[model samples]
Target: MSALANAPFYVTTSGGYLLVLAIILPAVAVLAMLLVPPRHVARIAFAVMAAGLAVALVIVAELVGTGMALAYVVGGWQPPLGLALRADGLSAAMLAMTAVVICATGLFARFHQCLEPETQDGRAATTFWPLLMAIWSALNAIFVGEDLFTLYVALELLTFAAVPLVCLDGRAETIAAALRYLMFALLGSLLYLLGAALLYGVFGALDIHSLSRLDGGAPAVTVALGLMIAGLLAKAALFPLHLWLPPAHAGAPAAASAVLSALVIKAPVFLILRLVLDVAPSSAGPLAGQIFIGQILIGQILAVLGASSILFCSVMAFRQQRLKLMIAYSTVAQIGYLFIVFPLAAGTETLPAWGTIAWTGGALQLVSHALAKAAMFMAAGAVAEAFGHDRISDLGGFGRILPISALAFGLAGLSLMGLPPSGGFIAKCLLLTAAVTGGHPWLAATILAGGLLAGGYVFRIVDRALATPAVELVARRPIPRRLEAVALVLALAAVGVGFVPLQPFGFLQLGRPAVSAMVAP
Candidate 1:
């Protein structure tokens, strides 16, 4: 029975079609948007968003019910010769989370677009809907792509879809920012492609599962891993490579900002995680232990970079005079916490990284931050729309004018600050526990310091929201209550993630190689 179960199956499952549907639905919507009359575009986009959300939710339900990763062997051909689309626990979670954020962002954008009827067929409005769908499709592809080559294609698709959103307003500065983003992204892509080529040449397979079974400690393999990881870090905007993120995110429209901050950057980070955890080899022999040690060393190096990002970017966030720029900087800072999980999740000789508490913490942080940051961006957008400018100093008592938006911003800030009864708090606490237990005191210190710095920046916004301005500020136009509600709902979801059991998440471990199974005889 064990052998039978282990045998390769070239057939598709009942749920396999869902994966195809998830990727193609948005692409179809993009095509429809181009063909349909301009006036009907928003309606079609919303319809697609609703359908996409349902598909994502169904995928999650199917995974939870079956307790297995969903895989579709395209055209009944398996790896090495054909592409496969697979979603493990992490991918499914990210899929659902991405769908939720994209749906909310679409709703927000719809209202904003409607506010200016003249711009319905304008470049920003018509272009945004299709691009949004394109982004959704590319993100889905990245999550499900089982082959390195397929992922490279998905990354390119994502970049093309996202770069234009940055300059949707078509301003000179924004266009310049978009160009900077494109150039850096292309450079990262080239590096990643080179690394992929190296791996393919060495292993004769581009599939992750196949690569995982190979002897992974070869110098060539190490070099390829280094190149791939560095390229992904640049795309993820981690620390020193984060130069393109702030301007691109801040200058984009609010909906675009939410999508970029909440989703786009995560693709490369997800790839990094996959490369480190799935493709790397671990076994019981002395040589295997050395391989494990090398991987751990890499994890430690990443943790240090994560710490620096938290410290440096948090200070930058606190210093920003504009609300959107401050939030953009905060994104870079919050992303650090995700990387800090490297050392914590780098389990000892007796354990697997997937089984570590830090793994769950990291996943939770990713999902919670996506929700919270999306909410925060939308709220900040609302504030900017009402007041005409996002200058923090000039927007005193603006919360009184936009009470719901203020509430949304505060709720999102709760997660960012890692306050109690919030998902960010739970995630940080788990990571902190792992750090202390692992005897990594510096990592523990970094966690606390990051939280403190987050508090400072969050307080800056909250203080301005409540304070009375010396010169009263008037809203140029009133923000719709429903728009503020969308942000608040997302923020509440971020807080709600705290309620999950604090133990190592069993769901995230599902479909991953078992620690016991991997043990050598």
Candidate 2:
């Protein structure tokens, strides 16, 4: 690694202000929404989305142009005392993915609301704009925040914003689901905060850059990381801690479900990645013996949990009769792939974890899942909107009625099922290859089994779409082509990811050398 990669301090780059714009633009729009008339809220939201997307693109461009992480020290103050925002290649990918999904979701929600013009300026419609923008702001903040405490605050904002979205329809069941989500999420927040406090007390700093430079053998460090990972697992809805997800995701309106499933849960997962890779001590120096054992233990435990989630929730998804609930369960199943990366990407003395093929596979899975799952939810929403319900058995001949939605659903399923010409296939292949080469046959088996299970669940819906019912299915209301088109575009994007080379992507590795240098030395 170069000297620049070994630098522990952050330097404010020329384009660092773009990160601030990314976080604040949606927030400013959120405040603007509160002062505007109900009729103008959506307009403001649309404008913000456009600008936010542009900012995210610019951030990505600057990152590629400079070939370094963009960093901005707040108020010209350094970390361990003040705050900083940084965006690497991974962060830029996340920002761009978020912008695309949020934009697609906004269009979907706007069209869905237009189905009932009387409700266009109604409470639910108006309330959605501010909450959506708030989520955008929180997600952006989480992506760039350089400290653990800042991430915790961003998580709180995300939780508070996301909970209400679950109950936006104001149904008793939806409200109950929202409350369940809130309770579990709050418990997660408490655990995460406790861990952050412990870290700060031990090292006198909470910034990732500062902590990555410290020794990792202290008992407090281990316990703090354990607590934080456990807390993040709950928030991520990884299996066993995942009881709140299905109902909360399935019960929410389609746009809300898309955002929650595709974007919100990912924040905690991102933090976990940082914790394991950047903050965890490398297995070197005098304490190498102790730290190596600890790292392996954590990786194995998480891999087992991930395998269990993939097998168990996939089975549950196959059994669900409701369209949204099945997709919701699939979300949990898909999340397993990310956790399994911990073990698959375990570093050697010479190569860092992020340099492995498994790391690229995991990143691909995250981005592809975000795009594919959002399209699936939007397609399901369109189905429910066209018909009065989403019961798969009764949805026979649906393809004949809403061909666009049916096509979108099927295309998204291609990714979930790990089929060819889709991002999911390439991701799973990389992961499977890593598992085999890394001498983890069981994980390789689990990867194959998970793909099979995913196919079973996906084909159920596809079969229904191709079925000939005794009574022909009919649309309860006409769905706009534009609404369906948004989902198709997202699904296509998911598919487009397959075109990338099947290797550790250079783009994803752009800003990782610094962290790798710190962790592996």
Candidate 3:
């Protein structure tokens, strides 16, 4: 039987067209921007943003209403040959998160540009719209793409679109940072392509569903998986390979920083999750001992790296003086929590990885970090815009001048610091519980240490915000309340995620049953 026949859920669903619309809408906007005059670019982008967000929402609604995954087979050809697009509960969540962040970023960028009316149609403004739309298109594609090669294409588009955003201001340092980012990203792409080529040579297929159905214990499979995971780690900016992130994120415009930190880095992490869970062999049956050893090695290695990232980077963040740099370092620290989930969520004889508390905790951390980090970046942008600099020590009494921005930053920090009644708190709490239950005490301690370090860095800023300056801080330029409100809304969303029941989320398990069944004995 063909792979599609064997895997029944691979068939297209009634609402599958929405997945195409989610991806194509933003791409069409990019093409439309090319045809329109420079002054009309932002308008076209705005319309597309609204439509794209609607499509994302409709897709989420479709998944919830039908209670099944959405799938579309491109050109009516089954996988291992033709392409497929699928949106499970996870993909739908990513799509919605992407839409919300991208739309907020669009508004934040528009408002920031409007502050200088004469330059509204200038090079930066004109370039930002098309690139932003391209990024949105790329993110949507990454979330839904089922073929490994297709995902690589989306990653390339994401990297190319993001590089220019980093250097939008044309400053010497920003240009250098963009070049560094481009070099690292291209290197990652090359490694990923090499791995995909190796996999195709061995299995004669690069489709995830097809690969998942086959035995994966061959030597070539091991090498290919390792290369691909390493490549994704570079793209995700996990510690030790994160040299390119701080400068690039710190140099980008605030809106671009929000997208890069909050969304762009997530695509690779998502792919890595798919690869480890979907393509790796099950630790059961005849080869159970070998497979179990391999799984432990991989999971433990990732967990150790994650622990290092959380502790080391949190300290780095605490030491940084510039507001954006501190947040950039904190992004790396927050990402560590996701990696630690691998070991904690390792499936047992009966339970699947997706059904674990650690899995839910990791997903919540990803979504909450995206919202909270984006809000923090936007708030920092407003601070820099008002005071003309981002040196935290120099911004004493900034809260007295930009009270709304200060409040937004503090609220966002609540999530980052893993404080009560915040999404970060629940996520970390679940992770801690899993670590303790799973007998991983060191991981639990690392989580606690990371949270404490995050609190320290966050408190440093709050202190500056409340401090009394010898000469009261003054705005170099007036910032509108609307721009500040955008950040506040996202911060609230991050906190709102904490209200979800503290159990394994059923929504995340929507399309995972087939894969879980295949992996089980």
Candidate achieving the largest lDDT: 2
Query: What does candidate 1 score on TM?
Result: 0.97
Model 3, span 51-164: residue lDDT tens: 999999999889989989999988888888889999998899899999999999999999999999999999998999999999999999999999999999999999999999
Model 1, position 256: C-alpha lDDT score = 98
- Tens digits of lDDT, candidate 1, 46-126: 899999999999988898899888889998877777788888889989999999999999989988887787986787898
lDDT, model 1, position 402: 94
Segments of candidate 1 deviating more than 4 angstroms: 1-6, 9-11, 282-286
Enumerate residue pairs that collide in model 1. Answer: none
Clashes of each: 0, 0, 0
Task: Pick the winner on lDDT between candidates 1 and 2.
Answer: 2
Off by over 4 Å in 2: 1-8, 282-285, 502-504, 514-521
RMSD to true structure for each model, in Å: 2.2, 2.2, 1.6
Model 2 superposed RMSD (Cα): 2.2
Model 1, backbone clash pairs (residues 3+ apart or across chains), number: 0
